[model samples]
Target chain A: MAITLTRTRRKKIHAIFVYLFLIVSSAATVLPLLWMISTSLKSGDIIFQIPPKWIPNDFHWENYYRAVTDIPFFLYLKNTVLITFFRVFAEVFMSAFVAYGFARFHFPGKNIWFLILLSTIMLPGEVTMIPVFLMFSELGWINTFKPLIVPAFFGGQAVFVFLLRQYFLTIPRELEEAALMDGASRFQIFYKIFLPLSKPALITIGIFSFQGSWNDLLGPLMYLNDSNKFTLQLGLAMFNGMTKVEWGPLMAASILVLLPTLIIFFAMQKYFVEGISVTGIKG
Target chain B: MKKLKKYEGFLFISPWILGFFIFTVFPISFAFYIGFTDWNSFTEPKFIGFDNYIHLFKDDNFLNSLKVTVVYAIFAIPLGIISSLTIAVIVNMKVKGIYFFRTALYLPAVVSGVSIALLWRWILDPDYGLINLILSYIGISGPNWLGDPSWVLPSYVMMAIWGAGGGMLTYLAGLQEISRSLYESAEIDGANGWVKFRHITLPMLTPVIFYNLVMGIIGAFRKFNDAYIIGGAGNQGQFYMVYLYENAFTYYKMGYATAMAWVLFLIILLLTLLVFKTSPLWVFYSGEVEGTKNKPNR
Candidate 1:
């Protein structure tokens, strides 16, 4: 009885240490973000105060207002949304279509083609970046949204295809077999059976593509030279490059830009986590 | 019609096939050809057989950037793996509110790229930056982080560690996949936490570690956005990708930049291949272990 009691006490003590460790580490993890929020609300004078204040005496909401006006925030937001929408639509539909082909069929050279597709994942984009930019320039697509949106319609990312294909393979063949027996076309089977049935997989890939298209910087930076065509990432980079950096408004702008991704992540936290694990394990 | 039926799969994947040729094959071939020439965007192509590649070996900027990137990768990859694995183990504990901690830790990774770079610029500010402010309270003066050449690599490493929680979900998944039966058997044999962790958890987590290692190598080499935004003193922060970008855009040395990109690709390939070759020694697959059990003890 005495030994069991001592063991239980030890376990309780261990639990306390574990909780304390988690609390302290998580606080550390979130410190910089919290500081950004606090700094965003502080007036210009207090932003760089000697002993930096965690909570300012006066909250300056004008910083967010300035962040919008100073950088053409709404225009950039629209541009970003436009590109993201097209890319998301393309990636969600096209990637799954390609994945379904790989999952369902066994044509000659299919394995070779699939291997090439898989190999492209390891091929760094930088190798193709310069030439592709020149190719777009030759086609008079530079400084437009075409370069950003067009490629996504083709196959999207190979990673997205691979994920969807893995998901598609797990779906039972019996359903497709039954549909075929009823004289349904392959296209009809794909549309009626596979598409609706793979909602979770589709949703996961959709979220991934949405995040990728939204957060992309290099794509916009390389393709779009016009201020009007600037995505939010390019706009933010331009804002940061200004001669005199306004710490307060900049932080506010940063917060606003990051808000969408944060909301998506928190709201769809399960899919995000699951998607990552899937990629990590399988890739 | 009968022959066409065998090729029906091509219809579904035709988009990828078209993209593969136009986007992948064509650009890569063009890039390779361009690397053998001196073609500024405005000028006619002048063939320069391997001059750019040869010059890169002796180029101070190329050498410095390569050295800086290699050094950063050396420290950051190991540190990142350790921190992330540690966070995963902690978060994997069957404690209440652990999900909240997981979410909080992962929050930064989701808010990556430009915002992260801008935020870190303030956090590492020498004067009134968060690090200095905190340091002053403890009577320990912090060095000029981004401004000091010596401190620049460490600053980037710090940022890498800060985002280490980005990889935590993978390790968590790996941890969860580990069979409870293995731990139960270890417990029955009177093993302590450290012993169980050393014998079971570490081996089981190797595949996850291996995956992260490959990714970490690629990420460290391809780092550009933050390096471009928050530059270090004396060009110490001019990572390989940043230099490649500058060469292409700022200098308009398209051919030379293409050569650099090729070189970067080769380096990554070699490193990744090296890891794969060495993986068999350390990475333990459960199926392979079962096969080995049938053989006599070495």
Candidate 2:
């Protein structure tokens, strides 16, 4: 009876321990973000106070207003939206088309082209930075959105193509075959059938592309010289350095810059999870 | 009918093919050609065979950048894999509110890189930072994480772990695919939990492990934004890519930078091939039939 009692108590202790660990780790994961919000609302002096306060006495709402008007925030926002929209559209459409070809066709050099595409996935964008920059420069595309948006249209992102191809392969061939027998053209079948079914994969690619282009500072910083052409990320960096690094405004701008990606992430959370699960199964 | 269908397929795929040729194939071939020549923005190309490659071997900053990159990859990849797997395993338990826990863990990954990095910069501020305050409770003085070269990579490692939600999600999916029947059988055989996990879970997870390893290595090699933002100009945190950027834009050493680019390409290619070569020994495909001459099932 004593042994049984001890065993039950030990199990209870272990359960409690596991719960404690989960809670602590989750808190640690979330604390930085919570603190960021808290600090952003605090006044400058209160932000750097020793023994940090959890909440501010006064909510400085003006910082957000200041973050916008201080820079050409509207211009930067417009550029980010424009570039991200085009980039995501191109990446999803082009990658889907290419992925379909890879999935369905048995043409000559198919394996080689597929290998080439995969190889490009391993090639670091940084390594290709200089030569690509020079190429864009030669084309007089510097200071424009061309360098950022054009390559995306070409299925430059091999990972997205690879992912879409994997998803497409899993789709039953009978669907395409049925469409074919109905006198439907390949394009019509792709548009009417494959695309509608691949909405999850497309959404996944769209979110990924949007997050990438929206937050990309390096590409815009590298290719665009004029401040007017700056994306939200580059604009945020400029905000950081404009004389006195105003923590409140900086944090506010950071949050604003982060909002779109966060909204998209939550909105399409299901598809994103599904897409990753599909990829993970193969991996 | 088949011949015309094939023609339709070709027409459907023409946009990608044309774009591939004009953008990818052309630029890639052009990049290689540029690497072999000394062409400034204004001047015509003067073929300077092997000069840029030779120069790269002697560059100290380039060598340091390589060392930093390797160090970062070594730390981040293994640590990220372990932490992510551990979280996935824990969350896979038949616990209440498991979905909430998963979402909470994954929230960081969805947060923008710039925001997270900025948050960390504040958190690791040495004096007034929350991390230091937490460490103070334990009577340990925390170093200036991002400012100090010794702690810079480790700080980034911490940041990487915070964003390990993506890998954790992948691992969770992999864990779910694991057969519950195997666990039941192991229990029936009087095998302990640890033994069952070691023999069953670990072996079954090898394919997912291999996938994460490849992705993590590639990602670590391409570490940019975090390091770039943290280190900035005049800081030793300038990663290999950052140095490549500086050379290309700051110093206008386009040819030299291009050569460095090729070297990076080779390194990544070799690493990928190495992973593939070793994958067959460990990566178990569920559909792979034994003792057959047929190609392994997709």
Candidate 3:
């Protein structure tokens, strides 16, 4: 009885230690973000105050206003949204379309084609980045959204196809066969059945691709030269360059830049986590 | 009609097939040709075979960038995997408010790249930064993180550790997939928590660990945005991709950059192949013959 009592007490102690560690680590994870928000709200003088304030005495909310006004914030936002929309749309719908092909169809060299697709997922973009840049420059598409947006239409991303293909495979063939017997075309069945059934998977990739395009710095940095065409990420980089010392407004701008993805992630938190787990574990 | 039906799958996948040639195959082949020449995107291409590849071995910038990247990878990959796996283990405990902990821990990773770089720049500020301020409370001055040469890699490593929770969910999924029956069987055999973890949990989680290892390697090599934004003094933080970008755009050494890209690809491939070759030895897949157990069976 005494041994069992000590064992339960030891387990209790262990639980306490685990919770304590979790609390501390979670705070460490979130502290910088909270500090960013805190720094954003502080007036210029207090930002450098020793023993930084978690909550400032006076909330200078104009830092957000200044952050927007100092750069073309809304313009960058619009550009980012446009790029993200086109890319995500193409990636989501088109990847589903192509995945359906690989999922449901029998064709010559299907396994070979699937293997090629898988290899593309593993192939780094750096190898092709230069020549592709050259190709775009040759076509006079530099400083244009075409380079960022157009290639997404081709097959979305190979990873997206892989993800959607996996999802599509899990879908039963009975529905498709039933639709075929009822005289539905493959395209019709795909549009009407597979796409609807895979809403969670579609939304998952939608969020993933949206985050990819929206937060992409190198693509916009490489392709879009004109300020008007600058995405939010590039604009943030440019903002850092123009005003290296403006911490308050810079933090404010940083918050503004990350807000969309943050919101999307939290709103669709389930799909986000599911998408990551699926790719990480299953890949 | 029969013939058309036979090619229907091709019709569905034609976009990717076309894109594979245009965006992937053609450019890679073009990059191969370009890697041999001295073209600046403007002048007529002067064919200087293998010159850029030869020059890469001798270039100081290339060599430094390679060192920085490799050193950073060495520290970051192991530190990141351990931190994330530890967090996963901790969070896997059946406890209250675990959901909140998971979400809060993952929030930082959702913040985009440039913003993260910018945030860390301030957070790691030598004077009046949060880290330094916290250090000052204990009567120790924090090192200038992204400023000093020696601290640059450590600074990035710290950032990598902070964001380690980004992989926690995957590890959590792996942890959850572990059957309770294994623990029950181990408990019947009088195994303690640590022993059970060692004998069962860790082995079962090896596949997930293997996956993260490959990804962590790729991520370390391809690290760019943060390194670009938060450059260290004395070019200490000149990562491989940053140098590649500078070579291609800043110096207009397109051919040389492509050579660098090819080298990067090869290095990643070789490392990945090495890991894959060794995976069967360590990565425990459940359910196998007892006699063949722990043997490096293909």
- Top candidate on DockQ is 3
Candidate ranking under DockQ, highest first, comes to 3, 1, 2
> TM-score: which candidate is best?
3
lDDT of 1: 0.88
Per residue, candidate 3 scores C-alpha lDDT tens digits across B82-143 of 99999999988879999889787777567767998999999999987999988888999999
List candidate 1 segments past 4 Å from native.
Answer: A273-283, B290-298
Q: What is model 2's DockQ versus the real complex?
A: 0.50
Q: Going through the candidates in order, state the TM-score of chain A alone for each one.
A: 0.93, 0.94, 0.96
DockQ of each: 0.70, 0.50, 0.71
Error of 2 at A268 (Å): 1.2
Q: How far in Å is the alpha carbon of A251 misplaced in model 3?
A: 0.4
Q: List the TM values for chain B, per candidate.
A: 0.95, 0.92, 0.95
* lDDT of each residue in A127-205, candidate 2, tens digit only: 5566577778878899999999988777536788788888888899898888889898767877798789988888877
Alpha carbon lDDT of each predicted model: 0.88, 0.78, 0.88
Query: How accurate locally is residue B138 in candidate 2, as Cα lDDT from 0 to 100?
Result: 96
* Candidate 3 wrongly placed segments (more than 4 Å): A273-283, B287-298
Can you write out model 2's per-residue Cα lDDT over B1-298, one digit (the tens) per residue? 7776555545545666676676566767878887988866567878999998888889899988988888888888898898888888878887788788778887777786666667777778888787898898899999888767788878878887887765686677777877777788889998876898798788767777888888887787777776766673235577878787787778877777788888887887788789889888888765463332222222
